[model samples]
Target chain A: MRLILRQRELVADAWRYAGEEAGADAPLIATLAELRTDPERHLARRGALGVRLTPVDRVEELATHLPRLALVACEFPGPGEGRGYSQGRLLRERYGFAGELRAVGAGVKQDLVFHLARCGFDALELAPGEDPAAAVRAWQRYEVGYQPGAAQVVLRRQRFFAATPPA
Target chain B: MYQYDELDQALVDARVAEFRDQTRRHLAGELSEEEFRPLRLRNGLYIQRHAPMLRIAIPYGLLSARQLHTLAAVARRYDRGYGHFTTRQNLQLNWPRLEDVPEILAQLATVQMHSIQTSGNCIRNVTADHLAGVAADEVDDPRPYCEIIRQWSSVHPEFTYLPRKFKIAVTGSPADRAASEVHDVGLHLVRDAQGQLGFTVLVGGGLGRMPIIGQVIREFLPVADLLSYLEAILRIYNRQGRRDNIHRARIKVLVKALGIERFRDLVEAEWQENRPHHVQLPQAEVERVRAFFRPQPYEILADLPAPAGNARLQAWYRYNTHAHKVPGYRAVFVSLKAHGEVPGDMSAEQMDALAEIARRYSFGLVRVTHTQNLLLADVRQRDLEALWRELEALRLATPNIGTLTDMIACPGLDFCSLANAGTLDVARQIQQRFDDLDYLYDLGEIEIKMSGCMNACGHHHVGHIGILGVDKHGEEWYQITLGGSASGVTALGEVIGPSVRKNEVAATIERIVEVYRGVRADGERFLDTVRRLGIKPFKEQAYAPHPAAA
Candidate 1:
């Protein structure tokens, strides 16, 4: 699933909800900052406020808190900051966060989708107007893995090596 | 040495195939020279002043007899009959043709070796103490960890294009034989409060241009986090290190620009973000690598009786060899740096002979020292005379082990493209000038290093009387520095004065010694004399405008 919107537009829209009284029928979408500090406050008001977590200030810190949340948006601050990649890995492998894991950022190019997915981020909120089909094709570009990562390569190598025993 | 397993073997083979393809494409004009430079350098091929020099990684200077023979075979076939062992424990063959390097690399791959990451702006060969596993004072063997790093740093995607070459040296002993303080990153293994082994990681220590001792960035890094922490450091350096100027490209310069505390904080921030979820070094994997270097079974025997009527063997024992950690064993140094000879140059035949002696008498292991000497680590005491006889026949038995004649001179202008004067010729002249072995033995452990230029490639600044060549009016002039030493305690040599004309260099050195000998304060060495009464006296005596007029 893809949500094509500029990160600044999303962030600025999220800020507009700051200190406002929410109605009971508000849609189940929340700003990113509310997920960081006072996660418990948002948790208490979850159903009524229709709140969802954003990039949890720190990945490892949120690993324990992630199981309770149904939706979390993993924000990439820039093109190169890779903290969210590790965050996605921990959410999937350690905490077993089964709900939506969305990636949001500028230059969220199609090539990075495979890595994000491997790290357990299933939804991508790319820069405005990026085609989802083009992003999906990027995931299938590289079939081989030279390094052991959270990607499909490790699993494939394990199966291949297990099937072939040394003489 | 860690023998390559199937995984390592497969990776190297694949890498060779990849490089061969790259070379083919370049030759076919598909890849431009600018595009292909980094690719060739990553594979350890460099187009130097005259030819393509290949620096092969000799991880930690530990090689089995078979590996040495393989190197010898490679040298004889692909290169000139010799290879120069560098101070960083890597071997460089000066005469390998550009086209033949891939085949030479294929030969190295057969022996579980390759030239990957030996040059260019990436991590160079990770050096460690030559006496690592065998040293008496070692906390633990550092080679296994070095090998682990060697694997991690080889062709690392992120670090392939670093601003400058990176060198990391690990030393398990407190003696610092590896010169850990003078490396890009120095890892000294030490026991912590709980008796667990960890590293005191020093960063930014280097010698060239701005020689600053590395500062301790991490007081104690757990052994398990070694790789991840190194990744953190390299990542930070690769991203933030200065690339605007080649002179300021080393990580040392970065650490200098940002104070040590600030640099440490930056590395810690990177580490906090990128700490691997699973520790890279599981105990089992560490053990698997360590098993390859398990100690050989040593014989337990009494000391040998004095040799029958052979004063030469006795003299060699007295001056040339060191005691081994094992009883009835000794570490024998074969001085290839003997005055006038190029440091660490062994003819193919001499190498073959040494290989034979190693297999026969020394548990099939040979070690190359940073001081440009070869060591037979496990020589049995009883076989000392026989070993000496064989070495003597091959001209490898030079009795001046650490004396004046045992000089460490680089291939100055003779072979090195960077040199200004003829270092080998000057070395030969000094050797011929002082041919008396007895006089050399009496001089007692003087390190005279000669570099062809001020680049300090010969480590001349650390020698007792360092000679640096300068180009004066298109003619070579020699500058003398005194009191430089690398072992036990390290000091940079002090310069004497105005440079001497090339023809007057030998006579000037003789005069410096005459002043040293005339001082006559019983048992004071040349360095001690220079240290006591500054270079002022030596400068006045040696640097007269015209010695003939004087």
Candidate 2:
């Protein structure tokens, strides 16, 4: 049982990632490789389905299976590894993923929580020893952003620089 | 010159508070140095050879007098008594304590300044032409577009942790004073066939171990599509660039490996996909930012005659001043490369004095040039003599701009951890050897750019006479290159011969220049001579055994 920031709340993670022993009743986050190896087998799994993505994994491979997937976990391998950000954006904006999007792996430090959320990750599985409270606080650090992000924090402020287009 | 509105102010303030907490966490041992390095670097804090260096962004090199004063005060209060202006048009405080940076950033924010994305693998400070608004042969000012890009790139979630650092440079004038051709992405402000404003986009140009000139990706990109198009390019580079190796990670390497056509196709596809999702840059916002750069309220005075003065005054007026687009104004260069001083290093006292002088003469504004000089971009022509006297008293009027001694050098082994050798001493050697102004005038516009390593912080690859310091076993050696220019005909310099001893660098330059003097046609600059006669003549003279040794 690990504490995770889900939609800006501290919650116990129920989804088990790769290399973890779990029962068939446990909601499992399978690897993209596993899904690609036996697509029909993994997609037809009982309970809620999820798929884990690495930095090099193509999100388009899971495009057709988005409706069946309930969780998409993008893994960051190490520092300065950013390909997962694009994966998160593609899963949300391009593929219109409706399930939970989680940022997980060694690079998921508290400092990156806001950026991960902005890239549309609703759940952040932060790195080991990172303060969960601080990770949750990072989401509300800035109430504004220059771009129209997927999980943008600002709700009331003017999103665009100009209220209306010039005449 | 753009003023920060409430939203901009709020963002910077929040950033300061966020960094404060990050610093607290690190100091409390909750964050390790390995985890904090990238975090601190993105905020412009670097653990240098001696101490932490905090680089404060002077966006596009424009600074208000108030901001300049605040920088001076910060330098006086926090670290050493001086600061170094980098080649990227940012100021680096060499000796700030890590514990004091958060407060330093707080002090800077009071005057609408921050160090966001100044370093690390993110979009660096967006640079534009130093003479943005006042250059005589100009199109639209590039600063507004630079500001727009700056806002978009600051803390940008997707692109902050790219494969490597990204730089974007914009130039409005056709002269290309900003060296946009050598940047990661270069934007040239241009008018389309229909009189609409747009950009001639160039991609993949960078200076490092493998220097390459950027290729034109778009003939004309409409003004409205700037951000979306840039986002497309960044997304392509981030997802596809080589991340295994640091040396091969720049966008230039990606462009070379994939070829510009394939890269452009990918970027075009990505741009099309992201265009509808992006908040389009509005015409009102463009006008809003452009309004900040409008012409100053100039007096109704006619052009004054050149003042009757001594030879030094005549030379200062000739070399240190540029033509302003307005009738009665001139852009003045405050020479930071004075003889016997480190290039681009300014004292706090000098900063305070210059701020006062700028307030008096240049509409309370100052600009930093890529060549490591401060500029008063809107000085009155009538105030030339008085300004010259004030600058001369402060040793800021060296009257050697665009000369061989007016070199660009980085903080080499003396301060930088990545440097292979020291550059300031070599810069001093060259300055002392070529002390004769008459000979420098005779040489005419030879850019001697020196870098301590191949990281190319000083942009040595594009200099007419490029000097790169090499670590030979334990001693320092110098490699010389010829005929690189960052202007309209942008090209990389070719190495002349094997590296010389560190002491022989100045002599090598002397031999090269003597050869140039002998073979140069009438009115030919050193670069023109090197281009016409080739590096063979200079190489023969430069590597020739010294007469003293013989």
Fnat values, candidates in order? 0.00, 0.49
Candidate 1 C-alpha error for residue A52, in Å: 28
User: How high a TM-score does candidate 1 get?
Assistant: 0.78
Report residue B442 deviation for candidate 2 (angstroms): 1.1
Error of 1 at B458 (Å): 2.3
DockQ of each: 0.05, 0.46
lDDT of each residue in B1-550, candidate 1, tens digit only: 6887666776678678767766887789865676568778878887766788888888888878888898999989988898887776778898998778888889999988888888778888898887777788889988888988887676443455577889999989888888787789999999999998889999998766665678899999998878778877876676577766878988999999999999999999877754434326666777888898898788778766656677778777877788667778788888786555676788778788899899999888888877777889888888999999998888888877777777777767766677788777777777877787776665666778888876666777778899888888778788889987655466777888888777677778877777777874788877888879888878777864565886
The lDDT for every candidate, in the order shown, is 0.72, 0.89
* Top candidate when judged by DockQ against the true structure: 2
Clashing pairs in 1: B339-B405, B340-B427, B462-B484, B462-B485
Off by over 4 Å in 2: A155-167, B544-549
Q: B355-441, model 2: which lDDT tens digit per residue?
A: 999999999999999999999998889899999999999999999999998899999999999999999999999999999999999
Alpha-carbon runs more than 4 Å astray in model 1: A1-167, B276-279, B305-308, B338-340, B519-533
lDDT of 1 at B264: 98
Task: Output the chain A TM-score of model 2.
Answer: 0.89
